[model samples]
Target chain A: MTPRLTAFNVVSLTLGFAFLYLPIVLLVVFSFNESKLVTVWGGFSTRWYAALLGNGPLLEAAWVSLRIGVLSATFATVLGTLAAVALVRFGRFAGRTLLTGMVYAPLVMPEVITGLSLLLLFVALDVDRGFWTVTLAHVSFSMCFVTVVVQSRLVTMDRSLEEAAMDLGATPLATFFQVTLPLIAPAVAAGWMLAFTLSLDDLVIASFTSGPGATTLPMRIYGQVRLGVSPEINAACTIMIGVVTLAILAFSIASKRGLAEPGRAEGA
Target chain B: MAEPPGRPAPLIRFEGVTKSFGAARAVAGVDLDIAQGEFFCLLGPSGCGKTTLMRTLAGFETPDSGRILLDGADLAGVPAHRRPVNMMFQSYALFPHMSVEANIAFGLRQDGVPRAEIAERVAAIVRTVQIQGLEKRRPHQLSGGQKQRVALARALVKRPLVLLLDEPLAALDRKLREDTRFELKELQARLGLTFLMVTHDQDEAMAMADRIGVMEKGRLVQVGAPAEVYETPATRGVAAFVGDSTLIEGVAGAFDGAAARLRVRAALGASSPEFVVAAREAPAEGSAVTLALRPEKLRLWTEPPEAGTPNVLEAEVWDLGYLGDKTLVRLRLPGGGTVRVSRLNASRRPEAGLSAHQRAWIGFDPADAVLLTR
Candidate 1:
C-alpha cells in the first residue's frame, strides 16, 4: 500500500528536521571556516582544528572527561546489572519498593536538582570536590539509564532456561553465571554504551561538583563560550559529536554482525 | 513384567502429600507407590493436580504436610538439583543457545564427570534416541520430533533412579507422539529404570503405562491397570473420566448375594427400565446407584433377540459416527436417555446395516456392567 503523504505532512517534516539539525550543521560547517569572523562563511580550511590541537587546558579537560566516562561507565554497568537482576529475578523482599524507586528516579529527575544535591552531599560529607567527585556524580545518575535498559531485557527473558540449568544439577550460582548471564549479555552491553554516552555528554552535574583544575570538556567549552563565541569551541564540539557518533555506529554494527553469524556448533 | 500384588519395595512413595498455593489446594492428601522398573502414569484432565503431584516428586515444590520417600529415604528438604531425579519438562526446555550434544551432556558436566566419559555417553544416547546427524543443530533448527528426542536423550543421559516425564510426548504430532510412546516404553524396559509420567491424554496413558492412576479434584480416584480401570471403575466420575462410557442412574430394588436389581427411570418420567446388574458389593435397598457401561460392551442389533434374552433395552439410533476402525452409534433409549454403543467394522460397510433414527436393540451381559454406589 502506498503511504498517504499530504502536502502539510511533507512541509512539516522538512521544517522539523531543519529546525533540529540546522544549527549543528552550521556549526560543523563554520568549524572549517578559513576566516576568523564567526558568521561570515569563508573557504574551507582546517586552521581551527590546528589551533584546538595546541590548546593545553582543552586537551587536559578532554583527557579528564575521557577518563571519567570510561571509569564511571564501567562501574555503573556492574552496579546497574546487579540492580536489574535483583529487581527482575527476585520475586519480592523488604525494601524492594524503595530500591526500585532509587534505580529509576534519576531518569526523570531534573539535572540541576541532581547536580545541586550531589554538591551538597559531597560538601556535607567534607569530601573535597575534584576529579573523584565529578566521576562519582556521573556514575550515580548514568547508572539509572543502565538499570532501565537491562531491566527491560531481563523481563522478557525465558525464565525456564535458568530452571533447566538448575534442574540439570548446577547450583544456583553456577546457573546464573552459565545460563542467565550469557542470555542477557547483549542487553548489558547496550546498557554500558548508554551509560558511557550519558556520562560523556553530561555538563551540569560535572560543573556543579568539579573543583579548580578539574574542568571537563563541556565545562571548558562553556567557559570559552562565556568569554566569546569562537570557531575553536565549535571545532571542539564537532569533534566530540564525531567521536560519540562513531562509537554508537561501531557498537550497532558489531551487535548486528554478532546476530548475523550462525549459532556456533560446539561439538562439531 | 508382572510382580506380586503386594507392594514390592517401591522406588518412590508419596504418603499424605499435600500442597497449597494460597487458599487453593493444588495437591491434596495423596498416597501412592511406584514400583521400581515399572512404567506408571498419572492420567487425568487438565487442572486435575497430576502435574503438581509430579512436581512434588521432582522436588520442585515442598509438600505442606507429608513425606515423599525415595528408595525408602525421606525426601523432605531436598532441593530439586540435589534429588536423584530428573524431569523431561512438557515444553522440552532445551536451551536455545546450546547444540543438542551440549544440552544432553549438561548434567554430566555438572557432576564433574570426565570429559571423555561425558562425550562417550552423550554419543551413545544420541544413537539410542536415533538423533544421529542432529547433534550439532540447535533446538530451534530442529523439528518437533527431533527436539523431543533430544529432550529424551538429555533426561536419560543423567541416569536418574526414577525419571519423571511431564507429558513427554505432548508437544509432538499424533504420528510422532505414537512412535515416541513406543520408543519410550521400550527404552524404559531395556534400561530397567522406573518411569513415572503424567499426561492428560487417556489413550497415551493406556498405551504406555503398566499401571494408570486416574486422578480428579486433587485426589486419586482409581489406580489400576488400564483394563482394570476401564472395566471396573470405583465411582461414576472415574467411569466417565477414563474413557467413553454411558451412565444409567437407577435405584437399587433387591440385593441378592451376587446380583442386585435396579429400576432405571427415563428422564420424561414415562418409561421404566429394569435390569439386574452385577456388583462386587451391592448397595443398600432403596438407595441411589449408577451403572457404568462401556460403549464397546453393548451390541446393537436391528431385530430384538429371543424373548428370554437378558439385559436388553430398546433404543432408537440418534447419531451414527463412522470412525475408521469402529462405528460409534448413539442410541436414544426408551427412557429419553442416550447411550453410545461402539461396533468394530469387521468388514467393509459393516455398520449393523443401521442408520440414524432406525429402531435398534442394545444388549449387554450383566457381568460387563459395573454398579457404582456414588
Candidate 2:
C-alpha cells in the first residue's frame, strides 16, 4: 500500500532535505552574484563563471583531479570486485577473518590516520609524494567502499546460476564472465561511481600525500577558501556539483533502461 | 549390485562413493548403477543425501572415497563443465539477463558450434519444450512454468549423456507439478536419455521412475521398481520413508520353511494377537520385527469377521480423513494401538458410514503385510 503523507511526515521530509541541501542551494545561487562578496546577494551575473575560465592553476587542478578520479576508481573497482568474489566464493580459507577485517578497516578508520600513515610510509620508502601517491592512497581507501557495495550484491546472488552455467558445459572462467559478471554489473557500476566521487572530493588524503606538481580541485578550493570565500570559488563548487549530478543522473538512467528493457520486451 | 542378464553395461556407476561435510557424512558408501535410457530416481526425505549423491554424478561434489565411472571411464578430476552430464537446478537457475534462446544456446556456443547450427538446435529445443513464441523474453519476464521449460530446454539442448534433475518440479504449483511429472516422464522416454532425478515426493518417484532408490541417512537402503520398493521394502526405514504405513511391533515366533510363512506375536497392549505373515526370509526366532501394513491393503468391515478369520482385528473408529478419492479411517485397537484403513470411495455415498466411536473390524491378507527385520 502506498503510504499516505500526513502533515508530520511532510514536515519531517521537508526539514530533512532542507538541512542536507540548503547550503548547496545557497552556494549555487551565489555563484552568479555580480558582487565579489559571497555572503551578500547582488544582481545575477555570469562574470564569476567567466572568471573561472582564465584561472590556469584551478583548471589544471580540476584536470588533475578528474584524471586521478577516473584512474583510481577504475583500478579500485577491479581490485575491489576481485576481493569481493574471493571473500564470498572461496569458502573458508586460512586467515579469512583477518583478510576480511583488513579489507574493511579503512572504511571505519579516520581519514587523518589513513593519510598520516600513507605519508609516513611514503617518506620511509623515500618515494616522491605526488599525483601517483595521492592516486594510490585514494585507491587504497575507496576500494573498501567499493568492496562493501559489491560484496553485498554478491552475497545475495543465486549461486546456482554459476553452477547451471558450468553444468551447461561452460568453463569456470566463461561462467564467471558470461553469467556472474553480467548479473553483478549494476553493483559494480554503483561501486565505480562511489569510488569516483570519493576520490574526486578527497582533500585530507590529497594534502598529505601530494607534492609540488599535483593539486586536486578540492585541495585548490580549500587553499583558496582559507584566504577568503569568493564568488569565483562558489562558481567552481557549482560546476563541480553540476558535473557530479549529471554523472549520477546518467548512471541511474542507464541502469533503469537496462532493467526496463526486459519488461518492455515482454509487453511486446 | 548385480546386473540383469540381458542388459548392457550401465551408463553411470557410483562405486562405494562417500562424501562428508566436516563431521557429517552426506553420501556414505553409495554404490549404484543406472542403465542407459532409464529414468532412475533418488527418493528420500530431506537431508537423506539424495541431492548430494546426484551432485557426485554431475561432478559438482567430489566423493571423498571411491570412483564414479561414466561409460567405464573414471570421472576423477573431471570438472563439471567437461562432464558429459547436465543438471536442471531446482531453482531453475535460468540466466535472468539472457533471452530464452540465448539461455538454450549457451552450451552449444561454449563448444564453438557454428552460429547457424546453434540457432537451429536452439529453435528445435525451444519447439520441443513448446516455448517457441517466448524466445526473446528474459527469464524474469516469463512465468514460473515458462522458466522451468526454458531451464529444461537449456539442459536438453546439449544432448548430454545423462540429465540430472534436482527436485525439478519442486518450484511449481501442485497442479502444475502433477502435469509436469507426466510431461517429464514422456520427454525422457521420447529422448531416450538417462535421467537421474532427486525428489522427496514418493508419488512423483512412483509415477515417473523406471526404478527408485530410497536413501536413508546418507545410505541407499533399497533400489527397485516402485511397486517392489513400496510392497517389499528392504528395511523399516525404506518402508516408513516411501509411503504411509502402520508399523506394528512384533516378535518372530517360528518360520515354516515349506510354506514360506513366519508366525509373529504382535505386541499390542492387551489383545496381543499372533499372526502368520508371508516372508522370503525370517529373522531368528524370538527376534523383534516390524510388520508394515499399508492402509489401503486392509479391509474394513462394519461387522466382525468369522471366528477363524486370520489377521483380523477389532477396533473403534478414532477419526475419519475424507480425502476426495478415498477415505482414511483411523481405528483405535483394543490394546490402545492405532491402525489406519483407507477405503476407496468408488460410490460417492460414503461407503462404510461408520462414524467416530463406532466399532469396526479390519483385516489384511498375510501377503500384504511386510515383515521388516532391520
Candidate 3:
C-alpha cells in the first residue's frame, strides 16, 4: 500500500532532499554562470565549458582517470567474483572464516591507512609508482565493494540450478560457467560499475600512490581548488557528475530488468 | 532381499550403504537392489533416509561405508557428471534463463553430441513428454506441469542407464499428480529402463511402483510388492506406516497350525474378545503378539453374523465420515477403544442406515487380519 502523504511527511521529505541536494544544485547552476568568479551568477553562458575544453593538463588527467577506472574495475570484478564463489560454495574449509574476514576487511579500513601502507610497500619494494601502481592500489581497495555486492547475490541464488546442471552431465567447472555465471551476471555488472565509480572519484589513495605522469582527475581538481576555484573547474565538476550519474542510471536499469524476470535469482 | 526369479542381474545395487551427518545417522546400512526394466520406489516419511539413499546413488552424497554398484561395476569415486545416471529434482530445477529447448539440449551438449543429433533428440523427448508447443518459453513463464515435463525431457534426452526421480510428482497439484503418475509409469514401461523414485506417498508408490521399499529411521524396514507389503507387513511399524490399521495388542492363546488365537490383553471391550488370525508360524502359548486390522478389511454388520462367527467383535458406532466414494464408520468397543471400518458407498444412499451411538457388530475373516509378533 502507498503511504499517506501527511503534512508532517511532506515537510520531512522536502527537508531531507533539500539537505542532500541543495549544494549540488547550486554547484550545477554556478557552472553555467557568465562571470569569471566561481560563485557570482552575473548571467548564463557556455564560455566556461568552452574554456574547460581547452585545458590540456585537466583533459589528460581525466583520460588517465578513465583508463584507471576501467582497468581496475575489470580486475576487481574478476577477483571479487572468484572470492565470493569460494566463500559461498566451499563450505567449512580450512581458514574459511579467516579468509572471509580478510576479504571484507578493506571495506571498513580507513582510506588514509590503506593509502599510507600501499605507499610504504611500494617504497620498500623499490618499484616505480606510476599508472600500474595507481591501478593496483585502486583495485585492492575497490575489490571489497565488488565482493560485497556479488556475495549477497550469490548467497540468495538457487543452488539447485547448479546441481541440476551437474546432474545433467555438465562438469563442476562447466556448471559454474553455464548455470551459475549467467544467473548472477546482473549483480556482477553492478559491482563493476560501482568499482568504476569508486576509482573515478577516489582522491586520498590516488594522491598517495600516483607519481610522475599518473595524476588522476580528482587529484587535479583538488590541486586547482586549493590554488583558487574557477568557472572552468565548476564546468569540469559538472561533467564528472554527469558521467557518474549516467553510470548509476545504467546500473539501475540493468538490475531492474534482471529483477523483472521471475525465477532467475530466487533464494533457495 | 534376494533377487526376484527370472530377472537378469540387478542393474543397481546398494551394498550395506550407510551415511551419517555429524551425530545424526541419515542412512544406516541400507542394502538394496533394483533390477533392469523395473520401477522401484523408496517409500518413507521425511528424514527417513529415502532421499539420502537416492543421493548416494546419484553421487551427490558419499556413503560413509559400503559400496554402490551399477551393472556390477563399483562406483566409488565417480563424480555426478561422469556417472551414467540422471535425476529429476523435486523442485524441477529448470534453468530459469534458458528456453525449454536449450534446457533439454543441455545434457546432450555436455556429452559433445553432434549439434544436429542434439536438436533431434531434444525434439523427440519434448514430443514424447507432450510439451511440443513450449520450446521457446522460459521456465518462469510455464506452469508447474509444463516445467515438470521439461525437467523430464532434459533428464531423458541423454538416455541414462537408470533414471532417479526424487519426489517427481510432489510439486504438482493433487489432480495433476495422479495423472502424471500413470504417464510416468507408462513411459518407464515403454523405455524399459530402470526407474528408481523416492516418495513418501504410499498410495502413489502402490499405484506406480512394481516394488516398494519401506524405510524407517535410517533403515529399510520392509521391501516387497505393494500388495505383499500391504497384505503382510513385517512388523507393527510397517503395518501402521504403510496404511491405516487398528493394532490390538494381545497374548497368544492357542495355535491350530493354520491360525493362532490371540486373547486380547487390552480392555478393548467388557468381553475381552479373542481374535483369530492366519499365521505361518505358531507362537507359543501366552507369548505377546499383536493383530493388525485394516479398516477396509473389517465388515460392519447391522446385526451379528451367525452364532460362533470367527473374529467377530461387538462395538458401538461412535461416528461416521461420509466421503462420497466410501463411508468411514468409527466404532467404539465396550471397554472404550475405537476401531475404524470403511464401507464402500456402492449405492446412491448417503447414509449407512446407522447413526452415532448405535449398536453394531464388526467382523473380519481370519486371513484379512495380519498377526505380528514384534
What TM-score, computed on C-alpha atoms, does each candidate reach? 0.91, 0.94, 0.95
DockQ of each: 0.37, 0.46, 0.55
Q: How many pairs of residues collide in model 2?
A: 0
Q: What value does the lDDT take at residue B310 in candidate 3? A: 81
Question: How large is the interface RMSD of candidate 2?
Answer: 5.7
lDDT of 3 by residue, B1-374 (tens): 35479767889999999999999999999989888888999999899999999999999999999999998889999999999999999888899889999999999999999999998898899889999889999898888889889999999988999999999998889999999999999999999988999999999999999999999999999999999999999989899999899998777876776344444443364556777777767777788888899999998888878898887888899999989998899999888789999999899977747999999999988889888887
Candidate 1 per-residue lDDT over residues B1-374, each given as its tens digit: 24368857788899999988888888889999988899999999898899999989887788999999999889998887888888888878787778999999999999999999999999999889999999888887888888878888898899998988988888788898888889899999999999999999999999999999999988988999998988888888889988999988777776666344444332323566777766655567778788888999987789988897778888899998989899889998776878999988888866656888999998888778888886
Q: Hey, what RMSD does candidate 2 come out at?
A: 3.0
Number of the top-ranking candidate, with TM-score as the measure: 3
> Better model by TM-score, 2 or 3?
3
lDDT of 2 at A98: 93
Worst 10 residues of 1 chain A by lDDT: A259-268
lDDT of 2 by residue, B1-374 (tens): 46679878899999999999999999999999899999999999999999999998888899999999998889999999999999998888888888888899999999999999998999999889999799998787788899889989999999999999988888888999899999999999999999999999999999999999999999999999999999899898998888889999999999999889999999998878999999888789989999999999998888988888789988999999999999988999999889988988898787556899998999989899999999
lDDT of 1 by residue, A63-97 (tens): 99999999999999999999999999887878999
True lDDT of residue A206, candidate 2: 94
TM-score (second chain) of model 3: 0.96
